[model samples]
Target chain A: MLKTIKLGLIVTLLLPALTYAHGPARVKVIQDIEINAPVEKVWGIIQDFCSIKDWNPQVSACEITEGNANEPGAIRTITLENGQQLKEKLIKIIPEQNKIQYMLTEPNIKAFPINTHGSSIILTAIDGGKTKVEWKGNFYRSFPGPNPPPELSDEAGQEALSSFYIAGLENIKKLAE
Target chain B: MHFHNTVILFLALGTSLHVSAAPFAYITNQGSDDISVIDLAKKQVIKTIKAGHKPAGIAVSQADKRAYVSNPESKDISVIDTDINLVLKNIPVGNGPVGIAVSPDGLNTYVSDWYDHTVYILDNERLEITGQFSVGHSPSGLDLSPNGSKIYIANRDDNNLMIFDRHKLSLLATIHVGKAPFGVTVSRDGQLIFVANVQSGDISIIDGKTNKVINTVKTGLFPYAIAHDDSNNRIYVTNQRDNSVSVIDLDKCKVIKTIPVGEYPEGIDIDIARRQVYVVNWFDDNVSIINTDTLTVTGEIPTGSGSRAFGRFIQFSDLP
Candidate 1:
């Protein structure tokens, strides 16, 4: 008899299966890009909280709604070029790690996508002053029930956020570099 | 993070306990609409079982020597007799049936209908719908209490966990957790419930007795699913985007070690008797096996693309 299971991470039996979500909606969007600039240079541009407008062409105007700049509880409202208004609140700002956590909260704001409230942007330093910026968001579509409209479906929500992140990251990379 | 030498000692201790001369695992390939059965003893794929369209969730009944796979696209459950390794029938289920779980006794199976917001109960012997429970929006993960008297459903869209009385078939309580709670499992002792919030990248710990969320432990990005190992008192969480497993020491309530694995790691399970951890990487078309004691990747087995392997998936010894 062949004894295939060795003591270490039983390397042999890798069973593959898919189809678990119950047709659940795509509720998350995470994308990142590598930059040639230093971590400090990149962090300096984004850490300002309200500086998103200068780096993102989609963001037409940003106003500090509450608290001081870079504060964990500071609230800011960003108006997109399409006149969509998004209210965002800073959850935390860790300068040591060059990370910022924020959440979107408003009474009835339907700016970019539905339920795209919480987001995080982190900067990691690579070898020789290179930097990596990861912009991630956790959200769902406006329609929560079954058979969402094409614009508010899971694919639409993910597509909207993916495009937003790609555009924002591309512009930021060009400016930072 | 420094790993203790105690892991080596435990590994030496675990090697002697595995009773089976062979171990096997079944993975669901969504794109191919089939199940890939792997012979763990050989580290090779023994067979690919043809299944329905978009076969997704699978639950193995140790009591009955059968495997129930939920085919969302086909809207049916394929029951496989493990001894013969053959599909007996495709039991028609609700529309968009996704998450599936069998009672510990193997008498009943639960399948969550994604589009209907309900769970269908099937009798193991007859493969027929015996009962149904209306739940919240997008119930993804369905689990049972340690004693199998209670049911826990992780409602993905509602951001809540609905606890139900198994026999009574009535809603017990609903506890709000993090955003988009997807995967859920109850502790062995039935005291704790761990819900993986995909959107929040955290695990919400619910005290079963209180039906309240006691703590939320932050993990890596896009935590799709989790599995608990009682012997080590640790929970393994698969981070889809981070490509790592967040090992949380249950006692300390923190992520102790982040074990990196393949791309888009989704479904995860811990084989306690073997002291091994298995993760299905959705995009990588393979499963990464890790030695829990050493906290290292020990083996890799390739499978079909889009492997989700959502539920408990280890085939133990029925060897004579």
Candidate 2:
């Protein structure tokens, strides 16, 4: 319990510095996929904010740290396969629009190479009981200076986030279909 | 004879448009590296002009028929000929040129370098660097008084607004404001100055004569820039994080209403003649048009991707 408290203190101290540490330019990544199942099935697979661990193979585990799942202001800490953890907060969830919006509470450069990120997932019903899932992320590279190393560059951040979103969308398709 | 008549008609239409044209908003899209020229009457992107890398800040001068765009990543400024809707030149500036302002007479342009703690002055006619002066850390937004006597700059890192005498090139006063002040704007009559505080989520109103903050008005989350509607006695502030615009009633000196806009609205400007406010949304790549009289968002014009357009971007129709 003491170790956990220390870690929380460290995170609290580092929040402002990490949040403002971003490059001049912002990068956007959008990916979408059509599933064979209906909108309800697709929403069921990803509606819970903590369900990312079950759908995305890259996320090893997830735990709700604050508030409840699928509710605004809910916070979750997800551990990646590489052991890096990312804390995210749920911004909003619109059931009528089939949209879920969330943002990174604290950036983890080791896992995503991004300073700040806001992501949204939307479900659209098609004509033949099919659902289209669109996932989008707007973020900035973690490296604050110009000419960052390839690992921390904007391209790297974009590639990592697009792949992550695509992987989650593909997995959701598989589970829903 | 038919061709001659067609030419005559074309020339007459062009002359009329030149005499009475609707205002054009130059929206700088950082992601697309271009400016979406939106004709206010049409309420759509009429043209796309390529600018320097990562164009963010903009200032339009109707008197000179030119628009200046600050490209922070490129370390340069793009000069656009408003008549032809084309870039005339990309003048290299300081280390990171972000916030820019043009004089009321359209004779000079002031650019604030974010990385370098200095503001560079350019001769509008010759388009040459004429002067430079140092300022506080991380200067983000800047504006000139209507009479062109004073220049107000918001130094974001220092959390203060610096008022400079334009003629003497000297700092008149540095007023401490809320945390992370990003945009500085002056009223039409030059009676007050509004500084948008991003972190504090409020605006500090400074009296021009005293240079002292008289009132603090609360805004939405992360207010980035401000636009004054003098006729309505209100100011519109774009809240970047909230994706909304806060209308502050100057008479009451408080927030009157919050109007929802596009995602991540970063830049805001008012067209006084038409009584409309244009808000450029960075994330949604659109401009939300707010009817000033009604204080409602009436239309959304789709612009290029990552439309920041940070500074004063509207060219009023009445200007020479």
DockQ, per model, reads 0.10, 0.30
Instruction: Go through the candidates in order and give each one's C-alpha lDDT.
Output: 0.79, 0.86
Task: Give the lDDT of residue B180 in candidate 2.
Answer: 83
Candidate 1: true interface contacts recovered? 0.13
A109-136: candidate 2 lDDT, tens digit per residue: 7678788888889899998999999997
- How does residue A127 of candidate 1 score in lDDT? 94
lDDT score for candidate 2 against the true structure: 0.86
lDDT of 2 by residue, B91-163 (tens): 9998888899999998999999876778999998787889999999878899999999999999888889998
lDDT of 1 at B120: 97
Clashes of 1: 15
Residue-wise C-alpha lDDT for candidate 1, range B1-320, written one tens digit per residue: 01322353355346543333446788888767788887776666777888877687888878777789998767789988665566878999888788898998988999998878899999987778988989998788989997899999999878999999999999999999999888888888899999999878899999999999999999997797889999999999998767799999989999999998986688787778889888988666799999988999999999885787888777775633
State the displacement of the C-alpha of residue B53, model 2, in Å, after optimal TM-score superposition. Answer: 1.0
| Residue B73, candidate 2: C-alpha displacement in angstroms | 1.9
| Residue lDDT tens for model 1, A114-169 | 54446778899999889999987755455433454555456766787788888888
